[model samples]
Target chain A: MTTQAEHRMPTAALPADASGLLPAAEPIRFLDDDGGPAPGDAHGRYQRPATELLRQAYRAMVVGRRFDSQATALTKQGRLAVYPSSRGQEAGEIGAVLALRDTDWLFPTYRDTMALVSRGIDPVEALTLLRGSWHCGYDPTTTRTAPQCTPLATHAPHAVGLAYAARRRGEDTVALALVGDGGTSEGDFHEALNFAAVFHVPVVFLVQNNGYAISVPLSRQTAAPSLAHKGVGYGVRGERVDGNDPVAVLAVLGDAVESARAGGGPVLVEAHTYRVEPHTNADDDTRYRDHDEVEMWKRRDPIARLEAHLRTAGELTDDDVSAAREAAEAFADDVRTRLGEEATGDPADLFAHVYAEPTAQLREQARWLAEELAHEHGAGEAR
Target chain B: MTLTMGKALNAALRDALREDDSVVVFGEDVGPLGGVFRVTDGLTAEFGEERCFDTPLAESGIVGLALGMAMNGFRPVVEMQFDAFAYPAFEQLASHVAKMRNRTRGAVGLPMVIRVPYAGGIGGVEHHSDSSEAYYAHTPGLKVVTPATVADAYSLLREAIADPDPVVFMEAKKLYWSKDETGLPVRTAPFGTAEVRRAGSDATLLAYGPTLPVALQAAEAAAGDGRQLEVIDLRTLVPFDDETVAASVRRTGRCVVVAEASGFASVSAEIAARVQERCFHSLWAPVLRVTGWDIPYPPPVLEKYHLPGVDRVLDTVDRLQWDDAPDSRFLSGAAT
Candidate 1:
């Protein structure tokens, strides 16, 4: 555990060329392909997460995958405007959420609806942004989760500020900001890391390097040795984990979150994962990537691998697997029923909440809209 | 009992920090440097590093940090140092800071103020002088306010920090040292109301921030010629006080907008359109605008020709046709 004194000292005051701050050369892994344990001491640095946590992550991933696919179907049925499937990257998605406490804040991106689902947010509230109902359906203050941010890397500094403020208020709250491989190229990401390091704030940046940001591949995103290695220059400890392995991802991310909570400065964890589906329902993956690469990643599916691991260890039974699938189907069916109806919102809602006290300008506009609506209704009655 | 605009603003920030432990002041050079213009002078000494501190020289990071801090229950007052330097933070202000409350359906509100020392006059070099208020005023969910008097600087900033929404507080750089004989803790008209600084009936000279003083000087100059030009200071641009302005314009029968920003889709243009729409029958002539030409800010040496001053304000007032006679010099012979 990092001492309190160590956490208070800025990185500039620390010794130069500290090896403890560097990332591992290879991505840390415990479970290998085909769900077999990896040979040798590949995961010796960090202890494996509790078995109960792994089981929970597995069940949540199953449900999360169902929710993601259902969301995609909803987009096709015109219930949602768009849905980004977190299909093959379930390990990273579930592990990151499972690593933190409910009090800890999660700053997810637009593509991180699966993480929101794992956080126990109502699935319908999670899909509101894509359904064109509201910008954010859930109250961030109550859920301790920011709106699924759309802009890349903009929320990174927000996490730093919240974590820093919590520290000042003597709260043990940590903030986890999730970013994609492409988001790391943004200037806000650099500033966030640097500010967190300088202030020694309790924040964690999880970069799910899913190989593609829209159509651009990881190779085009950065020339750095690894996205995690980009943290050393900012005085942040960096770690890389096999994102397909739930065991490794949970352990690494859990360790990072705890270290930060214990007052160790912010750490960046890059999970090597793949976007098994197109970037979103609106994207065409065939225009950029090849089919062979997709097939290779499909063999290493996070859900299938975790299920195999659990069964091999006698932790999960056929009955448990079937029960989980049944629950997921029920959840999906409820979502379909709720989203089937057309959303009916008051037109006056457009003028509400622009400010604590609605401005006179907005009041005038609202009056104009009211008149126009009344005219339309009256004309319809005459017709 | 006298104070400069810079000192008044500093007092406002200091008072805010003392009043609420949740208020924090931060930005590049805001710590020991006390800001380049010294508007944040002595704040760090009074409040300590936790309340007022220096940040990395990244504008976007500064604003983004303020947003997060505001979300965590701290009222952050950040400085952009200059007008043009704030461009880097435009995305954060537009995408997140400005839309946080509305996007969350009022679940979250950022009670913060972004203090920018704006506009030209001191002969600074490149990237120093710019009138970027129109960009912020055009954005919804943000209150764009600029104070022309020392007393307003103190009261408006204090009110802005206490407001339950994000505010872009533009501080006129040239007016920092402009002294007022009034004391601190003075109260002006509430926000969203325009003050007729110099009331008259001949014509109305609408201005805000850096151009208010210029408009007042033009009013004084027109008074010397036996014409009474009403000078109106539009303190807040977003929640614009159209009632106050329309009333004054209806009585005056003519209006001329003066601003340092380039003319061509600007706040000045918006005011002209609104005045015509509200007081169309009251107006005796078309609303005129005296603003910087539609070009990038010129070099410091050449800025005198670009910024609207007393002479320029009067020049536009001439087009009002006081005697109901068209000036042939401004008319095209082909039309005649």
Candidate 2:
């Protein structure tokens, strides 16, 4: 019998059906605009989850979008240093993150706050990094999520090593590291892929194809037809999914995660999507990207498509949709309040964690700071 | 009594593996062929493949996997085949191995050792002959150590394996076969201490790695005359043996720092600053440095001019003498 891994690999390239014309095919969508399954659904490996899980996924996507928008506003208002908005790609993050078991580890890049939130990270904690309160907002061991590595694709090898460790320890947990298309060009990405393939480690490299690395477009990044196909050279399974369709992403990722947990080695999942906003608050995409292309992707907004599908399916009423929006707004407000109320970190915290037991030199430095602070306080009291 | 640096390292690895079951040796070509330098010769045969095994060609993978093993309570000794090859693994070194203990708030400890054979003496091309100690020294959590003698070769390797933090043990590639006729030490040496090779009154010569021999040769040349020169070998760079360095410079009143790395912002530069700060009252002259030029290591034919040598060391000493300043003609000639 053919296994799930066999079914996941792309069977055929894009086809031309008509004799007279090659129509601009609607980019692959698992759920149509009317909340019905799309035509020629080929992923036979995964079964749809219960209706509750689907609703939860929808809620998560909404919350992720709300958090992304709030974070962008904070950056614009000068409260946050910078923010990488996940406004257009929430379905891709929510779908894949919701599919994984809590025991599995996540290695996310700077653009993966949506995935972190879907995996139960507090939105305030996630924004703490953007607010510049701490380099890493939360303890990774406590969250089972590594700090968002900003250096393009450097975290891939780290995730592969973690997966290798889990397999060695006989743990069923797998590791999923998320990176952008531009990261695929880095040597660490190739090293990670080669290592995962050679060792048969349970890792799923989730590449969010956002089309540009700052000003450099995907065309300049590689000649490969798609990032997913690059995995073929390493003897691992690769697939492209409708990143805007939560159901499709969930189905593909669920199968991949289960296959990995069962010792089926690694899979490379390329989420074909577009970055609706600039790379970050610091970037201005209007300079590089044609306005027409951005308008074209706006029609494929993940939130709009998913909301339309849910309303048509009678699974979510108009009132229910409005309630979801209101709940997300409230949650974002709560995050804003918490961010303002939390105590600022001490400057001495910089020297606190350089070593397990601070060395003599570090100790001396810490003492000097303490004395400096004490003298300042004394002067203030005397005045 | 005669032992090459490679043989000393081999003996040290064998002894560590025999003494502790926690010790495991790994790297590319380290198992069947006993490593590219043969520093791991006879290890696979003696300790079995499980304890001494070959890994894939990926250096980052080697270090990351060793880190995982270290987290699981294994004392892994990983070797990078060459100095340039270690860059691919620097992320793992700088990110996880060095910072994991602090990142986890002391819940985790990485007792791993990364052995890199570094520096140019033999005719190694550009990538093969870099002095990357400064890179490791710049990283906060990792300890950096280099050995220049057979005793240090035998003792420091064992000590690095036993240290609580990750240690970058840089072995000079050129000295792998340099033989020491003197006997090896009977006991293992402690980490974070400097070894004083000679006692002198005028000046101290501080060096490590392959340059330690150069400093000793310079000391011997100076001693041939009435001038006495002290020679110090800093076995460890981080948690640097500042006490020994300070005491030596205080007694000698002058110092000439030396290393194979380029002069600008080198470990030698740091040593000079620290010595000046701690021993300022006793110092008669500013600490001078006889170091590699601030350029990429030159081609083999021009390497003698790039690397600090006996002549350069003597020239620096001649500049430091207070009495020699009166002879304007001789001083001017030397200066020109």
Candidate 3:
């Protein structure tokens, strides 16, 4: 997926300042397109995770795929208001999120349900925002996770701010911020990167180059050599990785997270992935992209490739595959039952969180609304 | 101690940094150049580069960093080089910073201050002067305040920085060097509390920030015409001190809101609407407003005519009719 037509890796000119990120000549790769080990010596720097961890990672990836498909089906059945499927980019989602320590924070965007789920958030609660209900559906402080922001690149700066603040207050916590290709063009992205670079804040930024921001292609996003190289301008080091290869993504993100945790400053890792499905269930991707082009990417599916690797290694039995499938089915069944229940959106909840102390105006407005709602019901109830 | 508004602000920042370890001061050239208006002058020399420093010329970046730092427990006091330059960071301010605490259900509150030098009259170029309090006052999570006195600049800024929520402090560029030599009065009220700069009984004139001086001047001019005008300096716009304003209007039975922001759908409009609702019985005339025309800040030569001057305030009050003509909406049986 990190091909020439889309990402033309350009040479960055620089004076090598005290803290500029050194660009990797090529995106770090650990696996071939067919799931076989690729030629690279970079992985030799650190010990690979235990075999059991790899198995768990594989299961998590499978679960991520199941969630994506189930959520898409829910959207079709009107169970979910909308869903932005991380269908083809599950590797980038699972790999980056799993690398973070429990104490660290995860800043996800609207399309990052997989990342949130991997953090132990309940599936139904995770979809509350996507389901178009109340504000972000979970307690961020308890989970150390920020609400999935819809505005592009807006949360990136928050990640940098929190990280910088943590460092100043003598806390040891890193922030892992995720954004898409199109989000990289936003001014907030530039600012966050620049701030992270200058302040040496502990943050790991992963830009999932998913080929399109809605209908606009990557070429129209920027004329840079690659999205990773954009970090060089902010004095941040850049690492490009094959986003379709979960193994490669895990290794690269793991290294970056550790580097940040050890106070090596922030790192920008650009994962070359694809959005196999449309931007959202409401979008008609066929209007902009061709089926033939999408077919070429199907060969690089993160889930199928990893499953093929486990089979090739003789680590997978027929029973193991059947057990994973059954688990996914049971999870989906539970989701369907939960969503089948009625949703009671209380009107008073709107005034609950507007301020730490609701202002006089908001209080008055709330009182008026209560009176109006009461009056509408035949004025039978006393105020 | 006697000081200019600029000097008072500088002293306030110095005291804030010294008092709080988490308090940080930064902006473009704010460290080395002391800011264009010298508002943040000499902060770095006393606090060092770690606590006070400069950032890249990206408005969005400056604000984004402050937002994050504030979330993580730093009291970031950021500076926008000019009023118009703040447009780029509007998204960050309106989006994430303003909504984070509310979204988190108050698990965390942002104790940050974004200092903006705003309004026109100093013959500065375009974008150098603008009235942005309305934009921020319109946002829910932010606390918007502006100080019209040298003493208020010192006290209000200290209070804004010390507050637990994000504060948008709009410092008037034109009022920075005014020769008002006075310290905070002993009985001075808190930051959001309104100050009755001058008391009268004919009509109430409400103003804030740079326009407070004009409102007071309009009051003096009205007295020459044998009219007693009460002028209240609305120290803060968001927490809008309605008790003070309503009481004055009830006594005078008239009101005229003054601001440098455009007339249509502005803070002035909000004040006008609220005054009518609260003082409907006491009012003998409809609430009036004297503000900048619905247009952009023109060239330096044309700014005088654009900003709300004393003449405009007096003229608006002069035309306020008190013929005891019942409001059209309350005419006879129409109000039944």
Deviation in angstroms for B304 in model 1?
Answer: 0.9
Q: Candidate 3 — number of clashing residue pairs?
A: 4
lDDT of 2 by residue, B250-303 (tens): 998989998999989888888889899999999877788988888988888888
Best by TM-score: 1
**Cα deviation of B8, candidate 2, in Å:** 4.2
Tens digits of per-residue lDDT, candidate 2, A119-178, equal: 888876776677787767776766878778787877787787677656655677788889
> What is the C-alpha lDDT profile of model 3 across B16-120, one tens digit per residue?
888888899998889868888888888888877777888878888888889777766689999998989999999888987788777766776788899999998
Model 1 / residue B23 / CA error / Å: 0.6
List candidate 3 stretches off by more than 4 Å.
Answer: A1-26, A39-49, A314-319, A379-383, B179-187, B322-336
Clashing pairs in 1: none
lDDT of each: 0.90, 0.80, 0.83
Candidate with more favorable, higher TM-score: 1 or 2:
1
Q: DockQ scores for all the models shown? A: 0.61, 0.31, 0.47
Candidate 1 lDDT by residue in tens digits, A1-383: 11133335232485387678888988998889778898788786988778799889888999889988999999999999899888988998898899899899999999899999889888889889999888898999999999998889999999998888787777899999999999999999998998888888899999999999899998998999999999898889999999999999999999999999997879999999999999999999999999999999999888888899999999989998998899889888988899998965677878898888889999999999999999999999999
lDDT of residue A80 for candidate 2: 82
DockQ versus reference, model 3: 0.47
lDDT of 2: 0.80
